[model samples]
Target chain A: MRTCLIVDDSRVVRTVARRILEELQFSSREAGDGQAALAACQEEIPDFVLLDWNMPVMNGLDFLRALRQLPSVRQPIVIFCTTENDINHIQQAIEAGADEYIMKPFASDVLQAKLVQVGLL
Target chain B: MQAADFQFLSALIKERSGIALSSDKTYLLENRLGPLAAQRRLNDIAGLVAQMRSVRDEELIRDVVEAMTTNESLFFRDGKPFELLRTVILPRIVAARPKERPLRIWSAACSSGQEAYSIAITLLEEEGLLAGRPVEIVATDIATSMLIKAKAGVYSQFEVQRGLPIRLLLKYFAQKGTNWEIAPRLRSMVSFRQHNMLGECAGLGRFDIVFCRNVLIYFDEPTKKGVIERIAQVLAPDGVLLLGAVETIIGLSTRLEIVPGAAGIYRPVGSGPRAAVA
Candidate 1:
């Protein structure tokens, strides 16, 4: 089973991902914001990351940029699961090093597809 | 004069392999073709082009292509794939197999044979399921000369030192003069041959693991699709197909799916779980 870390301010979003990941036999951990995510990343690196874009403390893009800069962290398949799906927005996440892109309110299959594309599935 | 020679080599490579060198790589063009010019008793690059164009000697054309082909490789090149293979792929396969049988591997487009030998050495040092199995690793390249050098299995100290850990170097290789030659048993495990990715690969058999990494970057879209399709046909249903990190089969062919987070690692089209299969 793969390991996934879901970072979102929304309790509902994190709960939903927890269910989906659990169903997929993925061990999961959650962080309410980017700072928590970064800390959890240091504690134990997950094989995949579901990073919400517009979060408090540090936004997803900043978090991703900083995450990539961390020497201890290896490259993990990360997706920007955000409400923002604009082409330029998607491109920004990619430039910041997201492995895949998925919009918010994504179905389980869409989440599955994103994970598969980056080799998490 | 240099301009005339540059275009000649570029056009030859384009026609021969369908790989168009951007007009800007004049230095590379000159460097790769300079030796061929000397061999033909030519004074300069222009004279060499004239000789090559005169007869269209297919044998000489093959020689030019072999000479021009990029032979860049290092031990433990792209270190992560080997890590994944040891910690992830090999054990999964060994457990899934029915009995203690020989496992098969093919390193398609195995340039200068570093990738194949890396895999071999990794298996030799590996613990658990892969430790005991008899593995036949077929390493094929498009360049006959490269295959010959690969068959020699000798490396200068510098070449051996890179990508290879000191511990492994002490264990797997023996010093001959200033060079290191792979142990005979390890050398026997890898069979090197010439293989063209764009041509018929029907003669080559199937493999449980295929490492065609970084090879398709040189091919056009059609050639890439054709080569990948042919490999898909020969890859075992449960096998792994590794491509370069930036490369993907996306929107090209649906037969293989990404093995998420493993970079370009792919599973045979429909073999993985529903999550993996689109």
Candidate 2:
């Protein structure tokens, strides 16, 4: 099965994302924040990452930058899932190597659509 | 069973439900009706046929027909049609409609109501764009059992797990023991009824969008043509018809034309009847 890492501070969000990803036949692991997510990626890179923008210790953009720099890490599909809906923020995330952006509190279908758009689904 | 017996059952199904069964479908008929025969205390399919010949058991016949009707369905079964609805069709319909005109959607052969529910969710999510426009979704099936399950809006865990996103599932369904029941809001959006495609549909009135998906493959050419003609009659001139991905009205109906840029979508021809309802 394809592996997915769900990086979100909220346990509920992570659980929900994981459930959806798993439904799409991907095995998933979760991290509460970007710092934990970076460490997890270091241990073993995942095929896909459902990353959230806001988190304690290390934010998503920082994690993405650090992740892209790691020689051990291969290219992985990264989707930003957050409440930040502004164009500027979204453009920034994309510039920082986010593969796609999905607004917070999106339905499973919407997430699935984004995955389809990114060719990860 | 003998060839005559197979012929008898196949003809009966065709007459009653417009479902064409070829000789190769003998296995399908036997497989589907085996348990029904056992339930009726018949020895086998031949015994079941003998019983049918002896008595006018309307209920038994209905059960046989229902058993043969395919109830296969999934929430958002295909992604493209729903995507077209979200991006292009809904927006165009919304823009073309006069203010306060109701949007009527019909889900024909709506097995177990998943397709209808999925449409309702799509509409509900677009409430902002609708700007308080009234939306009505009518879900219909030939089988009473399917309609019952649909009306109850209760689904097994396995059912919801198929093609249903967790976010919408959590939002619209509440746990009922091991199964999940659709939330009252989403449930209320759809009204389930029993309908036959071969029968007159005038009583159901007209619709802006009709989803008659995946049901036509069971029909022969004449039956398919007749059904499409009736569907066109009840469709608003600007209304769209959605068939199963592989199903088409190409040679069946001249009353409609395909919607460009989308597969399996059609609209009534220019000379067709005007809008029956908003």
Candidate 3:
């Protein structure tokens, strides 16, 4: 089965995302912050990463930059899920190697659509 | 609501609009019309139905029909058709059309104008391919309320987030309070009109492409065939018709045929590449 690493500071957000990802037929792992996510990636790279914008230790943009540099043959597709709706944040996420950007408080269909857009689901 | 009331309202809706509600849509009637009834100071669905039966209030009838018609839409609702337009359809039309005659597109049943505006955005992005040729988009719906909203070009935060990418949203829309309003340039490209699919299409003129997506499913078989036949009449010799992903022309019309390798895309019969452009 395809796996995903969901990195978010909030446990509630991580739980919700996990449930939605499972419904989409993906096995998932959770990380509280970006630093932990990096460690998780080092342990075993996932097929996809649902990263948050703001978190302690390392932010999503920084993790994305670091994640891209990891000398792995198979790179995980990063999707930035956050409350940042502005163009600048989106542009920054794209430049930092995020495959897709989705706004917060989205329904499952919205997330599913983004996954489909990135050819992940 | 009583079964008779449900029967009356559903029949009334079908008569006015081509939308055919099934027996299982009782909750739909109550859910949609309940608020409408409250707004109009009617006691309940019963009062609403009684009012319609006794009085010949065209405005009330129109409101009921509009309420029942689903207005759920998002920008670039399905991404595939827009991609097809950008790559395959527009290029062909632009190559064949005369310089003086602008390429025209019709967004039939364009609820709140997303489909029409999406088409406009596609044209704007392909400015290089268009080579300075003019393009016009006519967006029409049976509901005047939807047409008014479409003309405004304002979308909620949720609506904009559905299928619209951040790049296009940032480029084409300006933030207005919590909602994003489409730029004036994009808004100017489309003209909104109150039109019924069952009515005459001659007034709308010929279209190089027609997007009649997701609306025909609500219609019965005969109504679906009638609508497609009418669209075929107004379509240019090489015009393309894009339906919803699930919609097809099979067993519906002899006037239209599905374009192979392109699901939900259709063209008028005998209007192949060899046919001269009118």
Proportion of native contacts found in each model?
Answer: 0.00, 0.00, 0.45
Predicted candidate 3 versus true structure: per-residue lDDT over B205-272, tens digit per residue: 99888999998999999899889989999998788899999988799888888887888899888877
* Candidate 2 ranges beyond 4 A from true positions: A1-40, A49-119, B271-278
Q: Give the better candidate number (1 or 3) by DockQ.
A: 3
lDDT assessment of candidate 1: 0.78
List the candidate 3 regions with Cα displacement exceeding 4 Å: A69-74, B275-278
Model 1, runs deviating above 4 Å = A1-121, B1-8, B274-278
Question: What DockQ, between 0 and 1, does each candidate earn?
Answer: 0.01, 0.07, 0.54
Each candidate's clash count: 7, 0, 0
Report lDDT per candidate: 0.78, 0.85, 0.89
Give lDDT tens digits, candidate 3, residues A1-121.
Answer: 8999999999999999999999999999999999999999999999999999999999999999999999998999998899987767877888888878888878888888888878887
TM-score for all models, in order of appearance: 0.66, 0.75, 0.94
Top-TM-score candidate index: 3
What digit string (tens of lDDT, one per residue) describes model 2 on residues B100-168?
Answer: 999999999998999999999988888887889988899988899999999999987567756665557
Per candidate, chain B TM-score? Answer: 0.91, 0.96, 0.97
